[model samples]
Target chain A: MKELIVLSGKGGTGKTTIVAALAALMPDKVMADCDVDAADLHLVLNPQIRESHRFLSGIKAKVDEDACNSCGKCLKACHFKAIRIKRTARIDELACEGCGVCIHICPTKAISAKENDCGAWHISDTSYGRIVHAQLDIGEENSGKLVSLVKMQVRKQAEAQKARYILIDGPPGIGCPVIASLSGTTLALMVTEPTMSGLHDLKRIAGLTAHFKIPFCVCINKYDLNPEISGQIETWCREQHANLLGKIPFDPLVVESLVAGKSISEYDSPASDAISAIWQKLQLAFKE
Target chain B: MQIAIASGKGGTGKTTVAISLALVADKPVRLMDCDVEEPNCHLFLRPDHMESQTMYVTVPEIDLAKCDFCGKCRDICAFKAISVFGKNIMTFPELCHSCMGCFLVCPNEAIKEGKREIGVISQGSINEIETLSGTLRVGEAMSPPLIKKLRDMTSDAMLTIIDAPPGTSCPVIAATKGADFTILVTESTPFGLNDLKLAAKLMEKLGQKFGIVINKAGIGDGSVEKWCAETGYPLLLSIPFDRKLAEAYSNGIPIIKAAPELIPAFKRLLEEVTQ
Candidate 1:
């Protein structure tokens, strides 16, 4: 099966809008939203959850006050500064990395590591196909782990259904979560706009994809907003030997459709036409 | 006082609001770009005479000569960054959380402290406003450590503005936590409202005082403003959707620079938040 992941180094560049459009266009595909921290694909697809599961990934350290000796060793050993001297030693859950170093250093064995429930994942049925998405709890860490879980679940669903494609909606930035979504994907479609920030971030993410030896293509969203920068982007794409997919014009209907909980493909607009053309080219790339 | 301009969704004008606020502040301010993965503040601020410093994160370096295959280090690691197979032992620097668990657990004292170059922190200034930013090395998985390093480098300016990375996860928390107040920038769309709720929930959990700024206000619906009213999160400012502003932003120009009339609004915003 071919896996296509949509990524944008900069956020709010219409990555979800494009992914949702592809979900409407592609017939045999399972969708996964790897933007676990700020998942938005579901806002358009409106998936009905089939199965829900709690994600228990890392551990958090807790200090038992009764067993604690006020030696302050645990406080001093914590690199995260999670441990503080409160009448006895106290561990701040937010600051704790679950490293268990305090547990090892405690003279009285007061500190213990317990598994943390970082978030929840769900398998759902969308009009397009099966989808796997997740929500990382507020103020929680280990978002990359939750993203991997979602990807693995969606891949399994795709294999079971014998689907031809798995379209993933990736989070913004070139950090841990983005890496988790991009690793080992068949193709990556980077959605960017015509702004300097967009071009700057596009270069950074392209460097990341190239570092992993992953073949990627670029598509400029709202190219009409700045035609000059759009031309500049196309020239850069050509110089870098990167595939320049079709560009979508600035259409207000894109937002109207989103507000009405529909994909641009389901609506009539120039952006919709551009996206359909991009989908056709993507299918060709998948076959190659 | 320190103010962090953040958004759960990307491209919601966090950097634009951050630079504008810093420029309009009455006193000297320090603008910190904590979005290490893809920092964009430098694109607009254009600080002069940039001074750079390499940032590093700690990882365990095992001494093979003194090492025995006890597997203690591997077992204690929560991130599973280290593995012991028969006579072989390996450490994946990318997976390591730098908790120093292996260094503490090694019975033979074989684990030594090592450093990995993750990114660079640079300092420069635009007149009275000093600028600081962190740029992560490409392919680096972690960003919180670099963000933390940048926060630690904050000077004692009367007003400090942080342009936090997009998302409500670790990096966002690292940049936003401990600030006096946070300004959550978002648009007026379904996706924007959804992510803004998540970001607002995070701030509440952290017990951070925060307000909202609705950007691109005229394009989408009024749900964002309605939600703010219902949740009692003060709606501080609204930047209407304008082609001229969009064109200016496309060319790496700050909003205040593009439209000088917005300066008074930003000044009032600074006053309101600082009060």
Candidate 2:
């Protein structure tokens, strides 16, 4: 099985739009939305959840007031400032990093660790094929762990269905969750736009995928927006020896499809033809 | 007063609104691009950086000479970054949360703090507005610590506009916390509204007062404005969808400079934001 991840260093650069378009062209693939922090692929693909598993990866700190000896040791030991000195020691759950310093430093052992429901992972069936996605609870951390879970589910579902491709729609930013999505992927297609911020973000994410020795291709969305920068990006891609995939033009249908809960490839628009042409090239890349 | 401009979705013009607000402000303003993972405000603002500092997180370093075969440090570590096996111990610096628990509990004092360069903080100025942006090193896992370090370099400007990173996560929370008010910039689209709910819920959870700014207002349905009215959340400003505005932004021109008429609107946003 091969894993193809769609990543854009900048968010809303049409990563999901590209993924959905690719899904339309490749129907037998298993889809995984690894942008757990701000998952929006479901809005486009319309996945009906089949199974969901509660994610319990880390711990949250809890204080037992009865066992507390107001020595303030736990308060002083916490690096996250999760502890506050109320009449009883109050553990600010939101601020806790699940580091267990408070649990270890309490003289009376007033603090303990408890499993936190970080989020939930779903194995859903989309119009394209099987999809594995997740939703992170508000104000909760550990998105990297949740992403790993979603990827694992994709692999399992792919094996059960005997699918050859596992396509991942990744999150923005080169942070923990993005790193988790990069692991074990066969190829990465970075979607970017023709703007300075787009170029700036592309440089960072490109550097990252190269650091992991992952071969990547660049596809500029809305290349018509700034052809000057688009030309500059093309030059940069050539210098980096990265594959320059076909550019998709700026089309209003991309947004219309998103509003209609559909992919650009499904709509009768100019973007559909461009994206379809890009899909043919990706198919050759997948075979290689 | 510190006003933060954030968006749940990226490229919804958080930096667009932020720079425009800073440029039209009558008083001296500070524009802080706290989106260290992808600091793009500098691209638009063209700030002259006066100082640059490498920000570091102090991770635990094990001195095996003073170490016994005890697992106390490993047992106390909440992040599971340390492990003790027989007479050997291992530390994974990336996984460490830098909570200092192992240092406090190490009986043999084997654990020492060591620094790792995570990102860089640069101090610059865009005309009268002082600007600071934190750029995270490529492949770094965490961003909240670097954001904390960036906010520590705050100027005493009467108006501080922080352009927070997209998403309602730790890095974003770290940026939007303690602000006088936050302005959420979003487009009027399905994806925008979906993510806006998460950002709104986050601000409510943080107990920080915030309003909404709808960019590209004419492109999609009016559900965003309708939602704001239903929820009684203040709709601070709306920038009409204009290809010219987007093209100007792509060329790195501030909106106020590109569309001079919007100066009055941003100035009004500044007044309403501070009120």
Candidate 3:
């Protein structure tokens, strides 16, 4: 089985839109949204969740007030400033880094460490295939770990269901979650725009894919917004020896399709034709 | 006052709104770009770099002499940055969260705190605004530390506008935390509204007094407006989706520069934020 990840370093650049469109084209693939922090593919795919699992990672320290021995050792030991010397020692839940330093050094053993429920992962069936997606609780840390969990589920679903391809919608920015989404992926399909920010973001993420030694192919979304930058991107793609997939022009119908809860390919517009062509090119590139 | 510009979705014009706000401000402002993974505010501001410094985060180093194969450090670490292979132990510094749990929990006192270079923070200034941005090393796993370091460099200015990273996660928290107020930027689309709710939820959790700036207005439906009306969340500013604005943004020009009429709107945005 092969995994294809759709990544756009800058958000709002049509990564999920492309992923949704591709899911419509390739009905035999398992879909996974690794952008756990701000997952949106499920909104488009309308998956019926078969299973939901709580992602427990990172430990938050809890202090017991009833122990009644406020020696203030935990306050001094905490470097995160999570423990404050109020009327009594209190732990700031937001400030806590989930480090158990205070738990270890507490003279009264008043502090205890507990695993935090960071987020939830879901196994769902969509029109495309078995899908895995996740939602990280607001303000939760360690989304990379949660992303890894979602991918693990996707792999399991693909193996069990015998799906040939795993199309993953990755998160924005070249950070931990993006790395987790890209690791061991068969191909990196990077979607970018025609703006200078788009080019800059593309290069930044391309640098990351290069570091991982993952071969990548670039696609320009809203290529008509600025053809000059689109040309520059093509030149950059050629200079880097990366594959340049076809570009999709800007169209309001694409947004309309998303608002209507349908993929671009399902909606009749110029973009749908462009997307169909993109899929053909993508498939052709994958063969090599 | 510190005003952080944040978005749950990327490319929702967080930097554009931030730059426009700083551009139209009557007085000089400090704009700190806290999106270390992709700090593009400098492109619009064209700031002159004064100095740059490397940022570091703490990671634990194992000392084999005083160590036993008991796996205490590995068990205590929440990030799983350390692992034991029989008598030998390996440390993955990139996966480390710098929680100091391994060093503190080492019964053999075999672990020592070491620093790893994660990224660089730069200090610079445009005409009237000082710009500070952090750039995480391309392959670095952790960005909260670098974002924290960038935000730490904020001096006491009348108005310090922080361009926070996208998404409602640890990095966004690191960037938007401690700000006097946060301006959550979102476009008027399904994806935008979905992510806006998440960002707003984060601000509410952080106890941050925040308002929303509807960017790319008229590009999509009016569901965002209806939601804001229902929730009573203040809609501070709205930048219409204009071909000129989009083109100028693509060319790295501020909206206020591309169209001078937008200055008053941005000024009003500041008034509403500071009011």
Candidate 4:
């Protein structure tokens, strides 16, 4: 089985639009939304969840007020500055990684580690195929862990169902969650724009994919927005021997489809001819 | 006052606002571009001289000669960057966040610290604006560590502007974490509003007072203003969709410097944010 990940160095590059179109093209392929932080692939696929599971990425430290001696040892020991010495010591939930350093250092045994539910993942059935995705609660860290779990569940479902391919819509930027989305993928498809910053971030994310030794391809969305930059990107890809999969023209139908909560392929099949070309190139890249 | 300009979504004109605001700082301003992965504020500011410093993290290194493949380091690693099973231990350095949990918990004390250069921080002065930027090594996995380095280079000033990286992830949080106020630069589009909400959530979660600067303020809809009004958040400044400003940005020119008239608006923005 093969896995392909669609990612962008930055958001608002029409990544999900391409992913949804690819999913529509490959209706038999399993899909997973690894961009747990701001997942929108479900809006297109319209998955009906079959099973959901709580995802515990780490522990949350809770202070026991009754056992508090106000020693301030934990506050001093925490490198993250997660522990604050107020009237009583308080732990900032956002800052705490649940490293247990506070609990271990607390002389009064006032801190204890509790399981933290960072997010939830679901195995769902969509019009295209089986879908695996996660919903991360606002301000909850560990989207990376949840992304990993979602991919794992997708792989399991794909294997059980004997699917030949798994498609993942990844998060933006070169961060932990993006790294997690790249795991166990046969190829990466970077969807980028024609702006200067877009090309710059593409190079960064491309370097990351190369560092991971993942064979990747690029598709320039809105290639006509700045044809000069798009041309430069093509030449650079040629020099690097990296695949420039295809070019997606600036299409307003994309926004129309998105506003209607439908994939371009479903909304206007004729309007997505450029994206269709990208999908074909992707399929060819994998076969090669 | 140190102010951070952040947008959860990319291409939301964060660098534009940062450079423009820095250009109008009545005092000697320092600009820290914490978006190391895609540092574009420098493109606008155009620093004359740059001094670079490498940022390193300490990762666990087990002395194999000590004859201890006891797997203690592997077990203690929360990142699962290391793993030892049946006499073979594997290390994935890209996955390591360098929390030092493994080296601290090793029973045989066989683990030693090994340095991994994550990225580089560059310091320089652009025109009158003192600039510091952190650029993560292309393949390096971690970014907050590098952002932390850039933040440490800031001086106590009347106004210090930070151009934070896009997204509400670790890097953005690291950049805007301790700022006195945060200004979220966004557009009037739906995508812009969608991400602005996420960035607003981050500021609210951190208990930081913040306002919005709507770039291309009349492009698509009034969604940003609607959301801001519903949430009772102030709309600090609005930069209209000016083709001349966009053209200047494309040419690597600071908008405020190119068009001096905008300086008054930026000055007003600074005052609004500080007050």
Candidate 5:
């Protein structure tokens, strides 16, 4: 199966909206939303969850007050500065890296490491196709791990159903979560806008994809908002030899469709026509 | 007071709002761009006399000379950044969280601290306003450490404005944790309201006193304002949707410069928040 992941180095550039549109256009595909931290694809897809699983990754250290000996060894050993010493040592859960170094150094064995339920993932059925998505707990770490888990679930569903394509909606930023979603994907579709921030972020994320030797293609969203910047982006794409798939015009109906909890493809507007054309170009790019 | 401008959704005017506040503040202000992954504040501010310093994080480097491969260091590593097979030991610096567990667990002192360059922190000034920003090296996964370092470098100005990355995760938390107050910027849309609720919950968890600002206000519906009213999170300001402002933003011009009439409004925002 061919795996296509959509990424935007900058936020709110319509990554989820495009992914939902692709889901409406593509057939025999399994979708996965790897933006675990601020997952919004489920808000538009309206999936009926078929399976829910707890995601347990990484550990957090807890101090046993009764067993504490008031020794400050754990305090000095922690590089994260998570331990505070007073009458007894206390650990800051948010600051703790869950490294278990404190557990090893504690003379009285007062510190113990326990796995945290960082989030949950679900396999669900949608009107478009089967999808796998997750929600990371508020202010929780290990989002990269949660993304990898969701991708794993997507692969399993794809293999079982013998699907032809796997569409992934990725998170913003060129961070751990984005990297996890890009690994081993067939092609990366970079969704960007025509703004100074968009061009700046596009360069950074393009550098990241190049560092990993990942082939990628670019598409400009709301291209009409700034035609000059759009021209600049097209020039940059040509100079970098990065494929420019197509551009989507600014459409107020896009937001209207989002408010209605539907993809742009569900509406008869310019943005929907643009996305359909981009899908055709994407399919051809995937085969190369 | 330190004020952080953050939004759960991306491109909702965090950097724009941050730069506007810094420019309009009457007092000496320092703008800290904590969105290390893709910092855009510098593009608009264009600070002069930029000086940069390399930022590094500590990772474990195995000393082959002091080698007794007992696999003890590999066993204690929580991130699995190290592995041992017979006499060969491997270290993946990218995977390392630098928790120092491997160093503490090594029986033979084989593990030594090594530095990996993660990013660069730059300092400069715009007229009277000082600016600091961290630019994470491409492909670097860890941003919180770099963000923390940037936050620590801020000088004691009368006002400090931090521009945070988009999300409700560790990076966002690291940026806004110690701020006196946070301004959550959002558009008046369903997606905006959804992510705003998540960001608001995060602020509550962090015990941060926060208010909201609605950008592109005229385009989307009024769900955000209604929610803020029902939830009692102070609605600070609403920047109406204007093609002129969007064009200025696309051209790397500050919002205040595009709409000079809005300067007094920003000044009032700074006063109201700090008061």
Candidate 6:
């Protein structure tokens, strides 16, 4: 099968709205939400979780108080200053990366390594198909790892069901998590807005997808917000030889759908019709 | 004092609040745009650059001639950025977390360090406000390293404002980590409220004290204000929804310059923020 990832370099750019609509349109596809840091797909899809798995990024330094002497050597070894010399030298969970250096360098061997529960991944059953999603802890790191895990789960489920496609709702910006989402995807659908920063970020993300040699198509969300900037974006895309997928106009129904915890397809059929055209073009472009 | 204006959601006026606050501050200020991936603070601040530095990260380069592809180098990598099965050793530099495990574990000394340009660190003055900003190289994967570099360049002064990236991700954490105080700028919409809650959770977990500035306050009802009151987080200032200001911002002009009355509002904002 094929994998199609929907990403917008900037947040709140209707990336999830389009993903939701696409999911509804492509009923047989397995889905994954790779935006673990602030995952909100569950707000719309409301998948019934079937399985859950714990994710561990690294070894967190834990202070064994009984081992005695609080010499604070672990604090010195920690580059992040995660160790706090409190009453018994507590480890700040948010600051810890599970480096294990602090534990190794502790004079009294009081610091220990333990499996830190960074987040949880779920194999859920949605109306469209099976979904692999995750919820990261509020202050935890390792979203990149979690995204990878979610994708793996989706692939495993897809293989079991002989699914034809995998659609991913990706996070904004080209960071570690975004890189994880982009890797191994057959085609990337970059949803951009009609603004200067929107065009700028689309280029950044487009460059990233090209670096990986992943074929991509661009869809400008809110194309009517500024027809002038949208035209410029279309021109720039043409100059770069990138496919300019159909543009979706500025629609308030997208917001209404989000607030109602529903997909655009379910919330507004007219908006879904526009998204369907974009989806149809993507399907034809990536057809084997 | 270093003040980082951050919000978990984009287009919530983090950059606008930062630029406006810096503009109205009487004392000298330094504004650092830690949101390297999509930095728009310069669009409003109109920073005149005086220096620029290319930021680089060292990735491992395997020596083919030295040749023994022992799996030790790949085993220690927590990110799984490297893999060696038999004689085939493949390295994914983009996935590498730069832990130097591969270099230290290479018994044949086959691994060598190579520089990769990830982003650029730009230093300048925005209308006499000593500014240092980072612009991530297009297609670069990581952002925290560049953010750390920018933070390291901040001068110790009365007020050093950082325009943090949206979301409670690694880059946002890196930007607001050790700040004296954080100001979260957000709107009153449902999405804004949802993401602000995430930002609040991040600040609370980081143990950094912070207040909130409600932008486009009357667009929605007082839900944002009510949440702030319920959570005991201080509501510092409010900027009403004005089309003229949005137009000015979209055209790369400071709101205070476009509307002089905004200066007093921003001044009052800083006073409340510092208080």
Which candidate number would show the highest DockQ if scored against the true structure? 1
Candidate 4 chain B weakest lDDT stretch, 10 residues: B243-252
Q: CAPRI band of model 2?
A: high
Across B74-191, the per-residue lDDT of candidate 6 in tens digits comes to: 7766667788888888888876656565776677989988777888887788556877789898778788878988888877755888999888877899899989889998888666
Model 3 per-residue lDDT tens digits across residues B1-275: 88899999998999999999898776678889899998898889888866898888989988889999789899877677999979989999887878777887788999987889999988888787888889999999889889888877777756899999999998999999999899999988888999999999999999999999998899777778989999999988889989999999998888889999898889888888877
All candidates' chain B TM-scores are: 0.97, 0.97, 0.94, 0.95, 0.98, 0.94
Kindly report which residue stretches of model 6 are placed more than 4 angstroms away from their true locations once superposed. A68-73, A84-90, A267-273, B57-116, B218-223
TM-score of 1: 0.98
Candidate 2 vs. true structure, TM-score: 0.98
Q: Please give the lDDT score for candidate 2.
A: 0.88
Q: Which tens-of-lDDT digit does each residue in A156-236 have in candidate 5? A: 999999999999999999998998888888889999999999999999999988988889999999999999999999999
**Residue pairs with backbone overlap in model 3:** none
How many angstroms is residue A220 displaced in model 1 relative to the true structure, after the best TM-score fit?
Answer: 0.3
For candidate 6 chain A, the 10 contiguous residues with the lowest summed lDDT are A96-105
- For candidate 4, what is the DockQ-based docking class? acceptable
User: CAPRI band of model 3?
Assistant: medium
TM of each candidate vs. truth = 0.98, 0.98, 0.96, 0.90, 0.98, 0.89
Tens digits of per-residue lDDT, candidate 4, A37-57, equal 767677667799899988887
Span of 10 residues, lowest total lDDT, candidate 4 chain A: A262-271
Name the weakest run of 10 consecutive residues (lDDT summed) in model 1 chain A: A74-83
lDDT of each residue in B1-275, candidate 1, tens digit only: 89999999999999999999999987578999999999999999899989999988999998999999899999988788999999999999888888888887788999888889999999998888899999999999999999999998766647899999999988998999899999999999999999999999999888999999999889899999999888788999999898989999999999889999999999999999999
C-alpha local distance difference test of each model: 0.92, 0.88, 0.88, 0.80, 0.92, 0.81
Across the candidates, what are chain A's individual TM-scores?
0.99, 0.98, 0.96, 0.97, 0.98, 0.95
* Candidate that beats the other on TM-score, 5 or 6, i.e. the better one: 5
Q: Is candidate 4 or candidate 5 better by lDDT?
A: 5
Could you give candidate 1's per-residue lDDT for residues A243-268 as a string of tens digits? 98889999989999999999889987
